[model samples]
Target: MTAELLEFLEELSRALIASGNSVTDTERILWSVAESQGVEVEVSVLPTMIIIKAEGEVSRMGLAAQSPGMMPLHQVTEIYRLTDDVTSRRMEVGEALGELRGI
Candidate 1:
């Protein structure tokens, strides 16, 4: 898997966590999002963590704390924009990572 794709997944997982979704739900949503972006991946989500397996070789996992709170619409919109930009090659992974961190 490409580094850019990996970075995208990581940021997306973070976004979902920030949105107050359970890790399992985040995994499901992220799988759909990736597919919508024309990327295929295998994901396994536990209550406290998410595991993504890509191209049968690369795997990435993220551990999330349990912080349940509503995410503002504007923040979610920004995340969607970031996903679009990176997936469409309009932005670099590093740049997107920086933006996501700020969010």
Candidate 2:
């Protein structure tokens, strides 16, 4: 479960960055999602990369292949909605991942 959550966070971080979120906003979202799930994660994000560390043998560093760019407004809205659902525990990690892929 830790690994799955970590993977989900890494992907979420990438998505947030790629969708033009600032590093600070991205970090806040990551922390909120992790904390809401009752997990402790160390997250660091730059314009080009993100690092996530957690217990239970989960660690990930994700590098962006390109610069951050704007996504469509609807896509950005979906991402925020997803984040909200996760933080509120209305969506499980697995289900969030599936929904994220669709975004």
Candidate with top lDDT is 2
| TM-score of each model, paired residue for residue | 0.67, 0.91
Q: Which residue runs does candidate 1 get wrong by more than 4 Å?
A: 21-39
Candidate 1 backbone overlaps, count: 0
lDDT of 2 by residue, 24-94 (tens): 99999999899998888899999888999986565799895554456788987988899899889888989
Candidate 1 TM-score over all chains jointly: 0.67
Measured over all alpha carbons after superposition, the RMSD of each candidate to the real structure, in angstroms, is 3.1, 1.6
Local distance difference test values of all predictions, in order: 0.72, 0.86
Look at candidate 1 and tell me the lDDT of residue 18.
74
Top-scoring candidate (TM-score):
2
User: What lDDT tens digits, residue by residue, belong to model 1 across residues 22-98?
Assistant: 76777776676566556788877765677777666578888755456778899888887887786676876678778
